[model samples]
Target: MSSSNSVEGSYSKRCAACKHLRRRCAEDCVLAPYFPATHPERFECVHKIFGAGNVARMLKAIPVQERAQAADSLSAEAYWRVQDPVYGSTGIVIQTNQEISSTQCELAKIRAQISMYEAQMATEQQPPPPGLPQQQGSLGSQENMPMFEPNDPFNFLN
Candidate 1:
């Protein structure tokens, strides 16, 4: 007989972070199943802080929970508030191996941008004293200059 509905089948990639925490990684996370088709990235999760920021923000919103399960990620205060005898809060602890989840092209783009900025900064930097006859930066002529002379840098440089 044909057992098509049997448990023998393939599975899709689930949200890694949610899976680690044993949380109900339902249809909420951007990396949920069939993500490549359904949620074609709003933004790459690479070095960009948007995804990390989102998770950090979510952690903040979820208040602390006391007497939490070892696997759950919720705070103690939050756990106590909604703690149930049957349903344990095991899916709270989120785990991840990667720091930056961005693509190669995007990483290159960010690096290039940083390099350009560094170059620009180096070029834009002006010497404290442009090595000209170290006169006071003031436009006042010698006759009009203040009598209280700050030690002239020209004396030392020359």
Candidate 2:
């Protein structure tokens, strides 16, 4: 029964590239796991943008641990290429830079406004000039009185 089961065991389906190429998928095929048959469109886009040979070469050039990341990058690049044939990812980068510049300009404007407000507050909080006499009494008799010292705790008049 085990022998029969082993004999009847199904072989894993070929990856997108192998299926598209009508070639046998080896056990250690590099593109198999990344380009599974479930997401054929992803592989199709990647394959269309970067040819199968180029994809295989890229995957082979990178270390095994980095292959998945490389595949993801390739897929994103392929998608962007389909969206913008002329500029692709460069268009995205440019748009992002413009957004950053706009945000920085807004931030600078806000900072300048804040600085102006702070300056106004500082001026508002300052004491009037010494030469400018404030009203001391209704009859103006106390106008000529000596300035009170806030730091003197003992009242000499008392």
Question: Which candidate number maximizes lDDT?
Answer: 2
Model-by-model lDDT, in order?
A: 0.41, 0.86
Distance from true position, residue 27, model 1, in Å? Answer: 42
Off by over 4 Å in 2: 1-12, 20-24, 61-65, 133-158
TM-score of each: 0.19, 0.66
- Identify the runs in model 1 with alpha carbons over 4 angstroms from their true place: 1-102, 128-158
lDDT tens digits by residue: candidate 2, 68-122: 9999999999999988999999999999999999999999999999999999999
lDDT of 1 at 104: 58
- Give the best candidate by TM-score: 2
